[model samples]
Target: MRKYIGELGLIITAFIWGSGFVVTSISLDYYSAYQNMAVRFLIGGVILGLVFYKKMKHVQKGTVIKGAILGSILYLAFALQTVGLQFTTPSKNAFLTAVNVVIVPLIGWAIYKKRMDKFEVAGAVLAMLGIGFLSLKFSAELNIGDILSFLCAIVFAFHIIYTAKFVKTENPIHLTVVQLLAAAVMGFIILLFRGEAAVPIVDGAVFSLVYLGIFGTAAAFLLQTVAQKFISETKAAIILSTESFWGMVLSIAVLGEVITLKMAVGAALILLAILISETKPRFLKAMPLREKV
Candidate 1:
């Protein structure tokens, strides 16, 4: 029961992130990617820094450096994702972003010589097919947005892997808070360089930025840091992979987007793949029956 705690945390994180797609879209109307990120992370970092002020005592030189690395990766990942959504449909961006889950294990296998089980491999294949059904139209030409989203997927995979390693040695809340601050710092530097530091003040933008900063960036990422300490990065990725599914559901239920047969089937396959990753193939296999006397 205790072991499953991390999985629960990750599921919650996924749900929060699922809402991010829509909220971010709203934010993009007011701020450029860097400006939005700059504002979002600054708000998140300050809030968490105040709320968890007690955790600051644990901060160390190593923590600062590690947090900066993680935060930089996070900023890049989120920046690319936010930027990519500009060119693609939210649905496509969400599903393509989830492709990082499949890439995680492959990265581990390649760089660290880590081996993936057969069930995990199967989940990857199923997930790939699901991605195609979810986002691809089998069109002759791919858009720049698709390419950007795919790159976002790759960057996120690195974030997941490195995060898993760092949380083991550092304090989760402290690391997470510093991570936000680091991203904010990087974003500010970018703003300084690009001269887009000034952000418009509007009611809708304010609400969107608050939701994104307080919940999406602060709460969700802290939970991820704590959760990944107990779970394998791969399993965590699989669980969070459901973000795309939640994105679809939220679009249909909240946004009143119409659903299609292909989408329904694709959603089912993605859910099935997640289940397979969690339970493995053996759980889904039927048992042999014996004749009764």
Candidate 2:
């Protein structure tokens, strides 16, 4: 049940993050990518950091170092993804980002000597196919942004696995807070060098920034850190990959967008992948079925 609780946390993280696309779009309209995120994570870090100050104060140096390492990897993931988005179509960016689901198991196999189980390999294959259909264009031309997005997937896979590893010894709250601070610090340095460090205040920007900081960055990452304690990296990635499906649902339900048949099929495949990963579905059962009368 504790494991289930952890999986539940990851699912909620995916939902909050899926919903974040909207506010993120709004926030981006007001500032440059790194500039906006610098503010987002800084604000989030401050809020959660203050609340967890007592815990953070007592944390060992090793824990802070672990969080900083996680945060650095996270910054690379976000930075690459953001820059990639600027250069490519959103669909392509998203599909490429979702490739992390497949990358995680491979990383696990290579780094931990944990071979990919049949179900995980099958699920990753299914998820990749689903993502391709859901988000990729047949004529999707290769470009620098696509390369960056793919690299982002690799880094994100590392982030997921490392977070799982680090959370074993450290408190998730302090880890989450420090990770936020790490990203915030990187964002600050990058924007500082570029001279885009100042952020302007406005109602729309403020609302989006607040949402991204509180729920999107703070709560979502915290949930992921805590959730990883109960789930394997591969299982966690498979579950988180469903965020694309949820994103599509939000598009249709909240944005009044029409669902294309292609999207429906793609969504079905992704759901099928999730079912395959989490349960003993008939799809993965062996051999000939009993004949029906």
Candidate 3:
């Protein structure tokens, strides 16, 4: 039952993150990417900072600093995504950012000298096929949004690598807070220099920022950090990749975007590949051993 509950939490995390794309798309109508991200992270960071403060038991002075660095990296990652989204369709953006799945394993290999399993290689090929289908519409002229989305993928890959490596070394909650704060601070600096510091007076825009900050960024990141304690990093990444599935679904159902047959087929292949790659028979074999203990 506890295991199921933890898995459910992770599922919810994926759903929330998946839906973030739609919300962000709507928010873009009223706010620039930098402005929206800045506002959201600032509020989210404050909320998380307060919540995690009470749980801080270790006086390890360097913990906050490390988290802040992680937070800064994380901020750049999302900021790039938001800015990139401005020039790309939500579907295209989602698919591109999802490239982090492929990038993660490669990053892991480069940094940790880890070897790629056959399943992972298979997954990468499937993801690349999906990317080809996704980029079909933009074959002639890849827009700024697409370019930014690709860049975002690389940064996000690094963010995942750093999180997996550092989250255990530092206090999870503290690390979460620092990363949030760093993003918020970075967003603020960008907002100021862009001369867009004026608070978005539009009620709808303000509401969007609040939603993204509190729910998408803060609550989501907290859940991810906590959930990772229970699940392997690779599993967590695979599960979160479901965000693309949700994004595509939401785009079709909520936004009334037409779903093409190519998208349907491509998304299915990618999903099937991720499932096959993630569901290891070895892990299932060990279940009985775990239960006996």
Candidate topping lDDT: 2
Clashes of each: 0, 0, 1
RMSD of each: 5.7, 4.7, 5.5
Q: Rank the candidates by TM-score, best first.
A: 2, 1, 3
lDDT of 3 by residue, 129-193 (tens): 66446434554568889889988888887776777677667677787777787778888888889
- lDDT string for model 1 (1-293, tens) is 64489989998898898878789879988878888899889999999999989778768989889989999999999878878888987667766777887898888888877766556656666766676676656645567787898899999999999999999999888889889999999999999999997777998789999999999989999989999999887887877876766777888999998988887887888777777877876753453322121
Cα-based lDDT at residue 130, candidate 2: 87
Per-residue lDDT of 1-293 in model 2, one digit per residue for the tens?
A: 98899889988998898888888888888878888889888988999988887877787898889999998999999999999998998889999999999999888887777766667667777887787888887664899899999999999999999999999988889899999999999989999899997778887689999999999999999999999998888888988887888788898999998999888888888888777877856656663422222
Q: Which stretches of candidate 2 lie over 4 Å from their true place?
A: 282-293
How high is the CA lDDT of each candidate model?
0.83, 0.87, 0.72
TM-score of every prediction relative to native: 0.89, 0.94, 0.82
Model 1 poorest 10 in a row by lDDT = 284-293
